[model samples]
Target chain A: SQTIHQWPATLVQPVGSPLSLECTVEGTSNPNLYWYRQAAGRGLQLLFYSVGIGQISSEVPQNLSASRPQDRQFILSSKKLLLSDSGFYLCAWSVRGPTEAFFGQGTRLTVV
Target chain B: GESVGLHLPTLSVQEGDNSIINCAYSNSASDYFIWYKQESGKGPQFIIDIRSNMDKRQGQRVTVLLNKTVKHLSLQIAATQPGDSAVYFCADSYSGSARQLTFGSGTQLTVLP
Candidate 1:
């Protein structure tokens, strides 16, 4: 069975501070990884997705960025955090083929 | 420009009654669709999925109906329970890119005893 792990289940960061959230998958290789930001009632917004290492496709322009350092390791980062950046960040992974993606526990970041 | 939208923002249902949540998509190329349920302060969980080729699919206590002609999708929960109370979202995808899904604004379902 495959499992996804996300760190810092909750974080409280100051405004303009740097942000880093990590997500990793086990029991699978070359999986498709995605980062999504979900706001109250706004739904899930796709921030970034990577089909392979060093290949990231940004869905929307924002203060956040994503990277795929290893086959199953994905990181979401920001040089500076904004008040609007605070939300539920989710990490998901799917097999290379047609399959539903599985999400992690998610990180609740609050920028004060 | 692909977009998915739900028909309602909130739905209140009585316990033991069936609940129906509806969604609509603007992308005609979308062939695959999925339904997810999310509780408060939690990530969305996969509930059920249906392909365009099929009109309906069933899970343990849930059913998903897809109407390609009208570009509408619906999730049906039978014998609704309090545990079933959550925000439900519908996602759509196409053939070439099956990994990424376009999600719709969720519908919050509240089960009342």
Candidate 2:
């Protein structure tokens, strides 16, 4: 079975501080990775997605950026965080085609 | 542009009752649809999915219905339980090489015990 893992399940960062969130998937190779954010009581907003290593597509323009360092390792980062950046960040993986995505336990980021 | 939207913002149902959540999409080229459930502070979990070729698909106690003519989709949960309380989101994907999914606002389902 495949499993996705995200670190710093909860994070509190100061405004203008740098941020980094990591996601790794085990038992799968060359999977499509995605980064999503959800505001309080709102639905998910796609931030970025990657088809392969070093290849990322931004769905929305924002302060956040995503990178695929390895086949199953994805990272979301920001040089300087903003108050609006506070939200629940999720990482997901899917097969090549249009398949159902498997998600990891999200990281709740609070930018104060 | 492609987009997915839900008809309701919230739904309240009693335990053991049947629950239905409705969604609508704007892209006629959409060929795949999915329903996801998210608990508080957790990532969205895949519940059920239906392709455009099929009108209905069942999984365990959940069912997904797709209507391409009306660009509408629905999710039905049988014997709703307290554990089923969560936010439900509908997603749509168009037919193309890049299979990107567009998600809806979502409907928060509250199951009262």
Docking model 1 quality class: medium
Error of 1 at A91 (Å): 0.3
Question: On residues B1-104, what C-alpha lDDT tens digit does candidate 1 reach at each position?
Answer: 37799999999999999999999999998988999999988888999998889999999989999998999999999999999999999998887664588899
The 10-residue segment of model 1 chain B with minimum total lDDT is B92-101
DockQ, candidate no. 2: 0.74
Give DockQ for candidates 1 onward, in order: 0.75, 0.74
Which ranges of candidate 1 are over 4 A from the true structure?
A: none
Candidate 1 per-residue C-alpha lDDT over A16-105 given as tens digits, one digit per residue, 9 for 90 to 100: 999999999999999999999999897898889999999999988899988999999999999999999999999999987656889998
Q: lDDT (CA) for every model shown?
A: 0.92, 0.91
Worst 10 residues of 2 chain B by lDDT: B93-102
- TM-score of chain A for each candidate? 0.97, 0.98
Cα RMSD of predicted structure 2: 1.1
Per-residue lDDT tens digits for candidate 2, residues A1-112, read: 9999998899999999999999999998899999989888677788899999999999888999898989999999999999999999999999988788888999999999
DockQ of 1: 0.75
Proportion of the native interface contacts kept in model 1: 0.66
What is the model-wide C-alpha lDDT for candidate 2?
A: 0.91
